[model samples]
Target: MIGSFVLLNCKKNREKEVMMQLKKIPEIKEIQCLTGPYDILIKVESPTIEELNETITWKIRKISDVRTTYTLKINEEATDCKDDN
Candidate 1:
């Protein structure tokens, strides 16, 4: 699986509506409201890079009032660092 942290901006006053819309997508595992330039943050996962792109480009970006999306892909190497004990 692939994981990503996505920061997005929504139209003024549409944050809640956008959040509700975003919750319907299964690929988006988590969502949170923000305080800075970004209005919302989300975590997404997919089995393949192509599917991830489709989720971001089509499923996410297509949502009404969504202005922009900045994606931070989770480093697979770092995620493997777990307590060996």
Candidate 2:
């Protein structure tokens, strides 16, 4: 699996509208409204890196109010929790 964390900034007060639109996309696993330089944070996942790129470029970026996006590709996972069977 491939994953990316996308930080988004929307035009004016369009965060809600953008969030609504983002929810329609299947690749977007999570969305969170933020309070900072960026307006929202999005978690996207796909079976391959190419699909991940396409989601970011074609789908997410095409939203009407989305101003800009900064994406971070996840390279590794570090966790302390383990499942007990």
Best by lDDT: 2
In model 2, pairs of residues that clash are: none
The residue-by-residue lDDT of candidate 1 on 42-82, one tens digit each, is 99999998999999999999997999999999976365678
Cα-based lDDT at residue 60, candidate 1: 96
How far residue 79's Cα lies from its native spot in candidate 1, in Å, is 6.4
TM-score for each of the candidates? 0.88, 0.91
- Global fold similarity of model 1 (TM-score): 0.88
Shift in Å, residue 47, candidate 1: 0.5
Q: How accurate is candidate 2 locally (lDDT)?
A: 0.95
Evaluate all candidate structures by whole-model CA lDDT and list the values in order: 0.94, 0.95
Tens-digit per-residue lDDT, 1-85, candidate 2? 8999999999999999999999999999999999999999999999999999999999999997999999999997556568777
Which ranges of candidate 2 are over 4 A from the true structure? 79-85
> Lowest-lDDT window of 10 residues in candidate 1?
75-84
